[model samples]
Target chain A: MEDTNSTIYALKTSAGQERNVARLLARKARTIDGIGISSILVPESLKGYILVESSTKIDLRNPDLKVQHLRGVVEGSVGITFDEVKRFLKPEPIISSIQKGSIVELISGPFKGERAKVVRIDESREEVVLELIEAAVPIPVTVKADQIRIIQKEAD
Target chain B: MKACTVCKMISSKDHCPSCGNPTSDNWSGLLIITDPEESRVAKELNIEIPGEYCLRVR
Candidate 1:
């Protein structure tokens, strides 16, 4: 799925506003003629930037396409390759990086904000068995992988 | 926003307007196709409609 004709450019945007910027750019590209903006990508893992695919270089200073939260094109950028954008296109599962005995912080549910040690991982279910570090007794609590953030990796 | 399970098109409806598939709220990555005819990304993803889409839907 490589495209040699169109070049991928990174557009800087305000943090937490990548979706808004992409939406605005999409609307502008449709209304304004000859902007050459083909597609806009807002990857969850990639923050503070959005990818724009175009046949030619985009002029961000164009008054007609002034979109809020859109800063400008990345400096010294000569377009990104398809290989670079491939990871964003198909992101790996959140549990792929987690390991047993890793220290994690729960971000949601009844155990929200609690620190825990990963005891076991069920890849098929996408759930993790964790032992709360702050609890009095070592009780295993199962949680969805997405609800926990890895705080420290288990020492090799 | 919800994403169609079949087409991955992002919308607020329970079913996709284009493909008539059930929509899911568990989705990641945003892809907006402004011009599908000119977009190489759109072509690679095989998206014909010009609209917001999700790269991954669960």
Candidate 2:
């Protein structure tokens, strides 16, 4: 969404330090004069970058706001649109995309790092029944939907 | 850290400092609003207070 007065600018930050840069920038924006930073967004999906809403372009040269992990503002005259960032604002449930017969890798718990095939999905409970791909016996294992990452979808 | 179910503001206490709503540890995404009035992002999310907030709270 475009506002008449303010624009959204993307700031390049060091990987794994988006939150730190955003926090430091917010603190600095409050103390410094003429820095019209309105908001800071650190989307988990977008690493090494944070979006900043301001009335004018942020001046990182100001020593007060020189965050340690901040690389610089993204080079572009045109600011990012609200539509472009909307997807990150409200993330969809992880379970919605998972389907039966999909290949997945266990991300957490005792079966971590094991590849498995999705057998059944319990949408209400957000759980999935998976069969270990490498196991000698086809044992059905139940896991939380979030515990597995989809590796491949079942062919139509 | 816990997030208030009502306002989604991140805090250490059980209840939200601003809304007094119960907070949950299961929350994700970090949004910081510095200027509620001038921020379009904050407006879209319906966030009024300027503080740390989570995008999703379970």
Please give the DockQ score of every candidate, comma-separated. Answer: 0.73, 0.78
TM-score of chain A of each: 0.90, 0.89
| TM-score for each of the candidates | 0.91, 0.91
DockQ-derived CAPRI band for the predicted complex in model 1: medium
Per-residue lDDT tens digits of candidate 1, residues A46-124? 8999999987777777786689998888867455878788788878999999999999999999989999999999998
* Model 1 accuracy (lDDT, Cα): 0.89
lDDT score for residue B26 of model 1: 84
Clashes of each: 0, 1
Using DockQ, give the best candidate's number: 2
Query: C-alpha displacement of B6 in model 1, angstroms?
Result: 3.2
* Two-chain complex of model 2, DockQ on C-alpha atoms against the true structure: 0.78
Per-residue lDDT of candidate 2, residues A86-152 (tens digit)? 8888998788999889999999999999999999999887799999999999999999887899999
